[model samples]
Target chain A: MPSTYSRTDLYAEVQQFYARQMQLLDGGAFEAYAETFTEDGEFRHTPGREPARTRAGISAELHEFHKRFDDDPVQRRHWFGMMNLEPQDDDTIRATVYALVVTTRPGGKPAIAPSCVVYDVLVWEDGELFNRSRRVEHDQLFGSAAAAS
Target chain B: MPSTYSRTDLYAEVQQFYARQMQLLDGGAFEAYAETFTEDGEFRHTPGREPARTRAGISAELHEFHKRFDDDPVQRRHWFGMMNLEPQDDDTIRATVYALVVTTRPGGKPAIAPSCVVYDVLVWEDGELFNRSRRVEHDQLFGSAAAAS
Candidate 1:
């Protein structure tokens, strides 16, 4: 079927997708968050490290990664903006967005972690958008570590 | 003329408008930033203070506000997300978005100022979107001084 979704529609859908996805991650719903991606989706959070492939792998990696903050009262909120969406001819959409992770603690000021640029490849499955792949580049580590990859 | 833009189109346009508007403000182009609003635009940055009315007033206020950072190496970036756009029957759009100001100083960590929720009434004039009025609610000051306003 020819794609009926306009550019504007795609933009809105993609933004909504990220909002929900980040919420699930920050809320510690690892399994549900993993479901937002394809079965064999790949996520590369670190440049020099290998990507966490497959839904199970993604969930497990995130689960371990977030364990350190479990004992802390800090709340992490992911905010995404300046998104650019490009639809490809192969029924896939490329989305690039700037991400800021805000950490706030009770009775203290909020802090911003290192900024990142995320590149996501999304596909439509059963009338829903799913991330097929995601690569995150940390702005502060662009030269030293990211260049090593 | 009846509105031809779809809900999705309006969302995309509003997001892009903010992206450009914030860039101009962070870049210290106060005159250009004020021009993005209507001639009689009202901006209330503080809850207990009177809003700055008119484009000229807005420009002057921002210019004086940013002067303190002239000698500092800190760069402030305004990031907005989680926008809710409602189109009114009278050809106006109401936008509510979460705003975060990230301040980065040279050779130091990035910090987040108090987060805010921005409410804006927008209208179309000369085929472009312009803010008619803006009211900012600081998240950290929800019950303290905001209650007095």
Candidate 2:
């Protein structure tokens, strides 16, 4: 590992990196976001579900997903809060947070969806940050059923 | 870091932790599940809302939330997907996920309430996990119109 940052610095780094990723997603920078991981990194979804186990696999999946969905005119803004961080030996970290994602369809008002709980396991290698594992714990779902009915 | 696990092992750990947390929530072990964080951990709600900045605060908030609404007899299962993780130096990590939470009302069957997105920042210390930050990005309120009406 390079130099270790203080808690405040570490938290700031984490927050900025996170914010940048979200910005990339909202700005349609899908490929840039995919490149953030290490060559052998993995991206897992739900705990029990199948995961993209390799960097290549994750990249390909992201590419495919963007190809299929990025063109939508709907606006998506990912909002996150309650960040928790801990130092694992000086190089790895385990963190969790709650998130609420808002997607506004064109010409429609925004809505408050249910909350989601997320867990992340991360490692720093070769001076760049890469995700070793990520688990998303979902919570309440807010608005869909009644609208459909 | 003690020893770097293979990508597969990391993914496995992520899955295991995710499953454990979910199982606890499903089994109504809310307090136990909340204990997953460090003493000074945080639980944040998104869309520019306030977050519980301490473990005790978050725990108390959840306890009250589940308790107050527990008698409502709503059985909820959170379905999570579209997860991504980022390494933020050593001892800290960041992640985001897409989620769909389904709430099954008593004898009403299961339905998708609303879809949401979450972002998490976590830390690992002493071989344990902790949350540093969380943000919720709510998409839409499903039953709000009817409730308002």
Name the best candidate (by lDDT): 1
Q: Write the per-residue lDDT of candidate 2 for residues A2-120, one digit (tens) a residue.
A: 58654545555666777887687667775676666566666654445577766568767666655655566777686654456666886787767555567788889776454455677
Model 2: runs farther than 4 Å from truth?
A46-49, A66-71, A141-149, B1-66, B73-149
List runs of model 1 lying over 4 Å from the truth: A142-149, B1-3, B17-77, B81-107, B112-149
Evaluated on the second chain alone, the candidates' TM-scores are 0.93, 0.79
DockQ of each: 0.18, 0.05
Model 1, DockQ value?
Answer: 0.18
Best by TM-score: 1
Worst 10 residues of 2 chain A by lDDT: A139-148
Candidate with top DockQ is 1
> How far is each candidate from the true structure, as Cα RMSD in Å?
6.0, 12.8
